[model samples]
Target chain A: MENRTIKMTTPLTKEKIKDLNIGDIIELSGVIYTARDAAHNRIKENYENNRKQPIELEYQIIFYVGPTPAKPGKVIGSAAPTTSARMDKYVEMMLKQGITGMIGKGERADYVAELCREYGACYFLSIGGASAMIANQIKDVEVVAYEDLGTESIKRLKVEDLRLIVGIDSKGRTFQEEQVKKYKISK
Target chain B: MTRIMSTEDLIPVIAKLCMDACYHLSDNVIGALKAAYEKEESPYGRDTLKLLLDNAELASKEEMPVCHDTGMAVVMMEIGEQVSWVGKPLEEAVNDGVRKGYTEGYLRKSVYLDPLNRVNSGDNTPCVLHTEIVTGDKVKITVLPKGGGSENMGTFTNLVPADGVEGVKEFVLKSVLAAGGKACPPIVVGVGIGGTMDKTTLIAKKALLRPIGNRNPNQYYKELEEELLEEINKFGIGPLGMGGRVTALDVHIEYYPCHITSLPVAVNLQCHSVRQATIEL
Candidate 1:
C-alpha cells in the first residue's frame, strides 16, 4: 500500500537479506553483476571444473541481461532484461554462491523459489524493454569475469535507484505459485 | 498489364515505414495499452504502462528504436493478380529494404544465417516474406517486425474437435501464462484455431497483424476474443508479467473451418511493442 526508500548494498549477506518482503518495490543502489543464459552456464562450468570458486556472491543482485554492444562513447547499449526462466537451472549454483537477490524479468521456477527460501535470497522483476532507461541509472560498468561472451559476459555495474519489484521473497512467495493457486480449476 | 517496382523506389518506403513503426506505437496499439493501463489496478502495471508511453515518445524524438530487439522483418504482401515482378527479383528487393532500413535506422541486426553458429546476416537479409495473390490493381505490403523475446514464446498444439471451445480457451491461457513476463506483458495474444497445423500457426500470427482493439470480423470470433481477453487479464500477469490486471491488452482470434476431426490451435504472444505498418502501391 505504501513505498519506503531503502539502499540495497551489493555483496549482500544473509543478515542483510532477511528483512525484505514480497510485493516490495525496491530502488536498488550499489554494485550488481549482469549475466544471462550463456554467462550462467559458464559460471556453472567454472564450478564444475573446480576452478577455485565460482561467483562469490554476497549482497549482490544478478541482473539477467545480454545487452547490445555499446555505441561510440557509451557505457552500454540498449541493455534490456532477458527472460529469467532461462536461468532457472543456475539458481541453485547462485544460491550456493550466496547471491542475495536477482534483477530480471519474468518468473523463476518453483525449485528456484524453494532455493531462495533455503538460502535467504530474493528475486525481483526489472521493467522489461526499459534497458536504455535503466542504463541511465548505472554509474559505472566493468567486466567482472567471462569477458569473451561479449554481451552475454559477466559484468559488474555500479547502479543507483535501479527500480525492481519483488517476484519471489525470502518468505517463499512467488507470482507463479500465487497464480497457479488462483487459476488451477481442477484436475 | 503488370507494373514493375524499381528496387530504388521500394527501398525508401520500406526504410521509412520500418523506422516509423519502431519509434511510434500505432494508434490502435496505443489505445489498447491505455485502456489496459487505466483498467489495471496494480500500481506496478500502471507504472509500466506509463513507462511504455514515455518510452514511445522518447524513442521518437531521440530516434532510438522502441525496443532494442528491433526484431526480424516479416513482410506480408498482397500482390495483385495482374502484377509481375521485374528488376532484382522480389526477394532481393525485400532484402534491399531490410538492408536500408536496418542500416540507416541503426536498428539491431538480430537475424543470423546459422542458428547454431550465430553469425550475424550482415544486413538482416533473407527476411520472412509471406505472399498472397488477390484480385486487385494495386499491391499492398505490410511489415510486422517481430521481436525475439515474444517470438521465442510462441507455441503450437494439435487438438481433436472434441476439445471444442474449452480446449481452445485452455490452450490460449496456458500459452500466455507459461510465457508470463517472458513475452513482455501486457501482451497482445493472437490465437489461430480450427485450420490445419501450419495454417493454424500462420493464422495466429496473422491475427496479430490485425490492428489493436479491433475484434475479429466473425461474431463468434469476436465473442471468443472478448472472453479470452477477460480470462487472460484475470491471470494478473500484468504489464511485464509481474502480477497486475493488464497481462494482455487484447486477444485477436482468427479461425478457419477444418476437417471435422481436427481442431489445431496456435498461440502467438506478441509483446507490447507491436510494431506494424502497411504500404499500398
Candidate 2:
C-alpha cells in the first residue's frame, strides 16, 4: 500500500483532526510544544491550583521529548520522542485543556487509549535511535517555558517536513495493535 | 610485584570509550539493522531502520552522538589482580571519565543527584561501575551508555525449576511484548539464567556485552535463543514498535549453576542503538 504524506500545523481543530487516521504517515511542519515527566508534573500542579497555564495550549500538539542539550553551532541536539506511557498520568488533564495531538514512541496504557477515544485526540511516534537523522528536519527550537528543567523544558519547535506515523487516530484506532496484526508471524 | 595502575591512566581510556560508543554503533549492530531492514515487510518499519542507519552514519562521520540520550555510562571494569591502582578509587576514576566524556563531548547531562530533590548532576557522572578482579596485569573497561526508555522496560524473576525453559521463554516474550515500541526494537534481548539473584541479573546484563547477532556457545541455549528471537519478532513489533515483521535482532543468554530450589531468570533489553565500546589497558 502506498502511504500518502500530508502536512499539518499545531493547535489543530477538531474538524481538521478528523481528517487524520491511524497509520497515516505525516510530514508535520509547524509549532509544537515539547514536555516530559517533570514539566508535565508542573503543568498539572499549576492547573490544579488554578494558575495560568504555562503557554496557550488550546488545541495544541505536545511532543513527549527531553532532547539532549545542543552543542555549539547546532540548532538543537537530537530531538526525538521519549516514552509516552511515562506521561500517561497527565493525558486526561491535558486533553481537558484542549491538547488534541500527542507524539511519542510506545503504546499507551489501556486507559490512555480509552481517553483518546473519548477526547478525539491522536498520537504520533518518531523513530528512536534515528535522532541524528531526525534532527535535520527541524528549522528552529527555543525553550518556551520551565528553562530550569534542562532538557525537560517545554520548547517551541519550528519543524519542516518532520516525518512521523500516526500511531493512534482520533477515532481510537491504533497502529501498535491494529497495524501490527497483518504482519504477525504465525506460530 | 604489583604493576601500578593509576586513575591517571584509567580516566582517559574510559573517557575515550564513552565518546567512541556514542559516536559509532558497532558493526554487528549496523549489520543486524541492515539485515532486518532488508526483510521487513512494512514500509514504515523499513523506513525507520533506514533512518537509524542514516543516523549511525551521520553520527560516525560527524563525531556526533547517534541519539540525544547519550545515556548514563554503565561502565564495567575488569581489574587484573596483579594491577594495583593509585590516586582516586576505581569508582571515582570511572565517574571522572564519564564526567569528562559527557561534558567535554557536549553530550546530554542525564544524572540526577537525588531522586527526591531532582538536581541535575550538570555533568553526567557517577556512572554505574562494576568491577571483577582476575589474574593479569591489564585492565579492561566497557562502557554501555544505557538510555532511559529501554532501561525502564527490563524484567527479573526467580522461576522455579518446574517452570523450566518454557517458563523462561514466556517471561522473555512478555517482557519484550510489554516493551513494544518503547525499547526501540529490533532490540538485542539479553537473558541471564541461574546463579544467585544478584549474580544472575548481572550476567544477563553482561550478555549485552556481546555484539548483536552473536549467540551463546551452548548449543541448547543458542537454539533456545534463536527460537525466542524468531517468535518475538513474529509479534510484529517491528522497529520503533509501531508494528512490523522484525522486533528483535538477537537474543543472548548467559547461565550459571544455581541451588536446587531456584531458577532465576533476568531479561535485560538493549535498544537498536546497541551503543557499547570496550578498551583494554
Q: Estimate each model's TM-score.
A: 0.89, 0.97
Worst 10 residues of 1 chain B by lDDT: B1-10
| Prediction 2: B-chain TM-score | 0.97
- lDDT by residue (B101-142, candidate 2, tens digit) is 887776888889898989888898888889999888988889
Chain A TM-score of model 1 comes to 0.87
Highest lDDT: which candidate? 2
lDDT of 2 by residue, A35-82 (tens): 899999999998999999889888899988777767789898877788
What are the lDDT figures for the candidates, one per model?
0.78, 0.86
Off by over 4 Å in 1: A1-3, A52-59, A69-74, A142-150, A175-187, B117-125
- Report i-RMS for every model: 3.5, 1.5
Over 4 Å off, model 2? none
Q: What is the TM-score of chain A alone in each candidate?
A: 0.87, 0.95
Spell out the clash pairs found in candidate 1.
Answer: A11-A58, A11-A59, A12-A58, A12-A59, A12-A60, B185-B240
Q: Write the per-residue lDDT of candidate 1 for residues A1-187, one digit (tens) a residue.
A: 3444456766667787677776677887788889877678777888788775434665667998766545567776566677788889888887777678888887777788888889888898777887557766777888878765556668888888887767788877885456434433333
The CAPRI-style docking tier of model 1 reads: acceptable
